[model samples]
Target chain A: MRIIRYSEAINEALHQLLASNKKVFLIGQGVTSPWYVGTTTVGLIDRFGPHRVFDTPVSENAVTGLGVGAALTGMRPIVVHPRMDFMYYAMDQIANQAANWHYMFGGQMSVPITIWGIINRGGEQGAQHSQALQAIFAHIPGLKVVMPSTPYDVKGLLVASVEDDNPVIFIDDRWLYNYEGDVPEELYSIKIGKGIVRRKGKDVTIVATSYMVYKAIEAGKDLEKEGVDVEIIDLRTVKPMDKQLLYNSVKKTKRLVIADASWKTCGIGAEISATIAESKLLTTLKAPIIRITLPDAPAPASSVLEQAYYPESKDIVLAVENLLKYSCDNNEKCDY
Target chain B: MYKKKSVNTDIPLKTLREMYLTMLRIRKFEETVASLILKKEIQTPCHLYIGQEAIATGVCTSLRKSDYVFSTHRSHGHYIAKGGDLKKLMAELYCRETGCSYGRGGSMHIADPDIGLPGSSAIVAGTIPLAVGVAYSFFLQKKDNVSVAFFGDGAVGEGVFYESLNLAALKKLPVLFVCENNLFSTHMPISACLANIDIKKTAETFCIPTARVDGNDVQSVYKTAKKMIENARKNKGPAFIECMTYRWYGHVGPNLDIDKGLRSKEELDYWMKRDPIKKLERQMIQQKILTIAKKKVIEEMIKKEIDEAIAFKNKSHSPEKIDIARSVFKEE
Candidate 1:
C-alpha cells in the first residue's frame, strides 16, 4: 500500500486506465493547463499528447454532448467539469443524452463514459460555488453516482467507473483532495454499490458520505469515551446505495443518524431516513431517525458562517446524543 | 454572378430515377401527414417538408449506411430520405408502441440506428457538436465514414454551430455540415435576423471547404453533396454546404400562410417554376427514359405503400403509461 492524497490517487487511476486502454481519452476546460485546479490530471497531456488529453472550449453543453456522442461510438471518454456548480449548464447533455442513450436505444448502445466533477462545500466560495448536489443526480434513474471520501476508495472506485458500461457521475469533494489515505499500488476496483464499515459498534448506526464520512469516523472515536458505541457506514455509491449493509446495521443497532453535507430537505439523508422508516426496521427503532445536514439555504459567503452551515463531527455527535436521550426519556429499550 | 453550368446529362438515368423516387416518397409522406393532422388524427405539431424534399433526398443519397446523419426540427423529409421505415415513422408520429423510439420520440425526434441515422434533435444546432464527435470517432477508429449534420439558416446564429465547425476543422475530422438555408427561422426572415447572411464565407473562416447550391435543384444538390462527402471520405477533412431552399408550409405545421410578409407571391411563383419533382419528370420524359404512363404506375405504387403504412400505424398500440419510466436508464 502507498500513502497518497486523494487527488494523487485519482491521477494514478486515470494514468493506469489510459495506459491500459488506447480507446480512453479526456476532454474538458483547463484540463491541459499547467495550473490543474484539482491537481488530479497533472502530467496527463504530457504523457498522452494533445490528441487524447485535450482542452475543449468553454462551451460546457457542447463539450458534454461531444463526450456522450464519442462514448456512444465506441470510445471511453472521461469528461471533467472543473466545478460541480457549472454542471447545470450541461445538465441536458448529462441527464437527457448520456444517461438515457442506452436504454432509449433499446439497449443497442452503451455509453462507457465518466463525468468527474469537483464538488464540496468549499470555504468562503459563496452560494453558487459551494453546493453538494449529489442527491439530485442520485434521483436520476439511469446514472451511477459515486463519492469517495478516502484516497483508497477514490482510486478503486474511479477505475470501476471507467470500466463500467454505463455513465458514472464521479464527484470529488474539493476539500478532500489534500486528504491522505493508504491506497494499493496494484490495479484494483471497488464494486459500484457496496459500502465500507469504517467503525463497528452496537448502540447507533451513522451512515455518511464524502466529507461527512471523515466527520463520522471522528465522531465515532469521540463517542467511544462516553460508552455510546457507533457503527459508521461510508456510503461510497449514492445511487445504487448499499441498502443491504445499511439495513443489516440498522436492524442490529435499532437506532440511526445520517450525516450529509448537502441541504437537509429532499437530500440523501432524507431519502435514507425514509428508506429506513419504510422498511421493517421501523418497528425495531428505539427512537426516531436523526439527520445531520447543512442548513436549508444557500451556503453563506462568510467563512465563519460557512463553517457553521456545513455539518461537522460535533453536529453528528449532537444528533446521536439527542437520539439517545430521547430513547432514554421514553423508557425504550433497543429491540431487534 | 457566374454563368449557369450545363447540366450533367451524362449521369445515368437510373440514378436520376432513384433521386426522383426519393423526393416523391418524401413529398407524398408529408402530404399524407398534413392530411392526417387536418383530419385530427395526429395531434402533435407537424413540420411538413413539402418543398424541401430535394435537399434531404439529394444529400442523403450521397451517404452510406455506415455514415452518420443528424437533422433539425423539420426532420420528416430527412427521416424518410435516410431510409427510415415509413410504417415505423408513421407509427412514431401516431404515438404507437411499435414506433421507432417506442412512442417516446414523436415527429421531431425520429431516429433509426440500424441505417446509421442515430436521431434528430428538436434543439437547433444541438446536433452539430454531436456530428463532430461522431466524425472524431471515425477518425480515431481510422474509418472512412463521414458524419453529416443537416440544419437550417436559423442554426447559424447558434454558438454551438461555430464552435463545432472550428473543432472539426482543427481536428480535421470527416464531417459535412449541410446548412439548408430555408430563408426563415420559424417565420423570421434571415435578412431581418442575421447580420451576415453568407454561410459559405462563415464556413471558410474556419478553413473548411464550402459550396453553395440551389437546394430546390435535386441534381445540383446531389452533385455537391457527393463531391463533399467524397472529399471527406478521402481524409481531406471537413466541408460546409449551404443549400438554398424554402419550406412551402408554415414553420410548424401545414399552413400556406406566410407570416411576417417576408415571402412574396412573385418569389414563391418563381421557385414553384423550378419544382424539383416536375423538373426531374420533364427531363426523364424528354430523354424518352421514362414515359408518363410509367410515372403514373410509380406514383400509384407509392400511394399503396403509404396507405399500408398508415394502416399499420393505425392498428399499432399506444405506449402504456407504466412504460414511461422504463427507457430512462440501462439496468445492466
Candidate 2:
C-alpha cells in the first residue's frame, strides 16, 4: 500500500477521473485555487486546461444548476462548495433539480453529478462557515451521501461517486485533510452503502461517520487500557446507509453508541437511533443506546462556546462510559 | 415522420402554416386542460397558455429536435411548441403511469428528453443555469446545437438569470435566453418590480447581443430567434430576446383576473387586440395562403388530437403502491 494524505488522495481521484474520461470536468467558485479548496484541484487546470476545470463567479445557485444541466447532457461534473455553509444558497438546484431529475423524469434521465462540499469547522469561523450539514443532504432522497475518514476511503469513494450515474454528495472535513493513511497507487472504487469495522472489540459497538470515525478510534484506544473493548465502525457512506453492517455490529455487541459531527436533532445520529428503534433492534440492547452529537444550537464564535457546541473525542469516551454505567444500573450488578 | 424544418427560417408558406397550426394546437391543449380542471377531470394546478402562444412557437421553430429548451412553470407553450408528446404530457397532468414522468411530476415538472425538452422547473429562474450548462456541454463537445431557456419577466429579477447570461457570454456557449415579458411577476407588474423594464439591456451589459420583439407578431419573433440561434451555433456566444407579451389568464390558475386590481381591462384589451394567432391568420389569408375553411379544419384536427390525449390519460392506469418509492435513482 502507498501512503497519502487525505488532501492528496482526493486530488489523485480527481486527477485519475479527469485524465481517463473526457466527459468529466470540474466546476465551482474556487476549483483551481489550492488555497481555497486545499490542494484538491491544484495544477488541474494546467494539465486538462480550462474546459475541464472551471473557476466560476460567486453565484452559488447558478453554478450548481449549471453543473446539473451539464450532467443531464452526458457530462460528469464534480461541483465544489469550498465552505458547505454557502451551499444553502444552491439548495433549490441540489434538492429540487439534481436530486429529483431521474425521479421526475420517470427514470428516463440521470444526473451524473457529484457535489463535493468541504466542511470547515473550528478555527473560530463562526456559524456561517463552521457547520457540518451532511445530515441535510442525507435526509433527501435521490441523493447518495458519502463521508470518508481515511485517505484510502476518500480516494476510492470519490472515484466511485464520480462514476456513479446519480447525484452523490461527497462531504470532506478540513480537520481530516492533513491526516495520512495507507492508500493504493492505482485507481479504484469503494462500494457505496457499506461500512467497515475500524477496531474490533466485544463490548460496546461505536458507530461513527466522517471525521467522527477518527475521534471514535482515538476514544477506543484510550478506553482499551481500562478493559473497555470498544468496537469502532467507520460509516463510509451514510445515506443508502450501511444498515446491514450496523445491524450486525449492534447485534453482536448488544450495545451501540453513535458519534457524529452534526447537531443532535434530526441529525445522522438521530436517524440511526430511529432506525434501530424502528427495526426492533432495541429488543437486543442490554442498555439504552447513546448518541454523542452537538447540542441543537447555532455555533458560537467564541472559542469556549465553540468547544461546547461541537462534539469531540472526549465526548465519545464519555458516552461510552455512560453506556457502561447504564448497563450496570439496569442489572444492579457491579461497580465501575 | 413529422420533423420541424429549421435549415433556413426564410419561413416558407407551408412552414408558416405549420407554425400557425402548432400555435393553435398549444392554445387548444391548454384550453382543454382548463375545461377539464373546471370539470374536476384534471386534478392539478393548470397554467393556461391562452394569449402567449406566439412566443413559444416562434422561438421553438428556430430550434431543431437536437436543440434543448428548459422551461418554467408556465411551460406547456414551450413544451408543445418543441414537439413534446401530447398524450404523455396529458397523462403527466392526470397522474397516470403512462405519463411523461410516470405520474411522478405533474404539470409543472413535465420532462421528455427524446425531443430535447429535458425539463420544466416550477421554481422561477431555477433552470436558467441548467440551460447554460447544456450549452456549455454542446460547446465543449463541439456540437452545433443551442440550448434555450424560456423564463418569464419575474425570473429577470432572479440572480441566476444574470449569472447564466454572464457565464454563457464569458464562455461563448451556444445559448438563447428567451424572456416572455408578460409584465407581471405573480400579480406584481414589471413597473412595481424593477426600476428598468428593458430586460434586454441587462443582458447587453454582459456584451451578449440582444433583441426585443413584438411577441404577438410571430414572424418577427421567428426571424430574431433564427438569427440568434444561428449565431450561437457559429460560436458567437449567447443572445437575449425579450418578447413583449401577456398571459391572458391569472398568474396561478385559468381565469382572467382583472378584478384582482393588479391589471386593468384596458391593458388586457390592448394586448388582446394584438392576438398572435389572429395576426398570423390575417397575414396568411391576405397572402391567399390559408382560407377560412382551412383554418376551421386545422382547429378541428387539433381539438380531435386533444380529445384523444385526454382519452389516453383516462385509460392509463395509476402507479401501484410499491412503485411510489421507485425512480429515486436510476434503476440501481
True contacts kept of each: 0.37, 0.81
Badly placed stretches (over 4 Å) of model 1 are A120-123, A280-284, A330-336, B1-11, B190-192, B257-274, B320-322
The iRMS of model 2 comes to 1.0
Candidate 2's residue-wise lDDT over A1-336, tens digit each? 878899999999999999999999999978878688988889899999888899998888888898999999989999999999989989999999999999987888899999999999887888899889989999999999999999999999999899899999999999999999999988899988889999999899999988889899999988998789999999999888988888888888888999998888899988998888888678989887788887888778899888788788888888787778777765454222
Top model number, lDDT: 2
* Candidate 2 lDDT tens digits, B34-115: 8778788878787778899999999999899999999888878888999988999899889899998798888888888989
Give the clash total for candidate 2: 0
- Candidate 1, B1-332: lDDT as tens digits: 55332255544566788888999999898899998998889986778888888899888988998899987778889888889899998998897888887787778777888888787777788878888888888987789999999999999988778878888898898999999998888778888878989988988999889999989889889888999899999999999999988888778877766454757777777777878788888877887777989999889988998998999997999988877777565555
**Model 1 over residues A187-300: C-alpha lDDT tens digits?**
799999899899999999999999889999999988998899999999999988999999999999999999888888999999999999889999999888888888899989
Instruction: Show where candidate 2 strays beyond 4 Å.
Output: A330-336, B1-10
Instruction: Show what share of the native A-B interface contacts model 1 retains.
Output: 0.37
DockQ of 2: 0.78
Report how far off residue A43 is in candidate 2 (Å): 2.0
TM-score of chain B of each: 0.95, 0.96
DockQ score for model 1 = 0.44
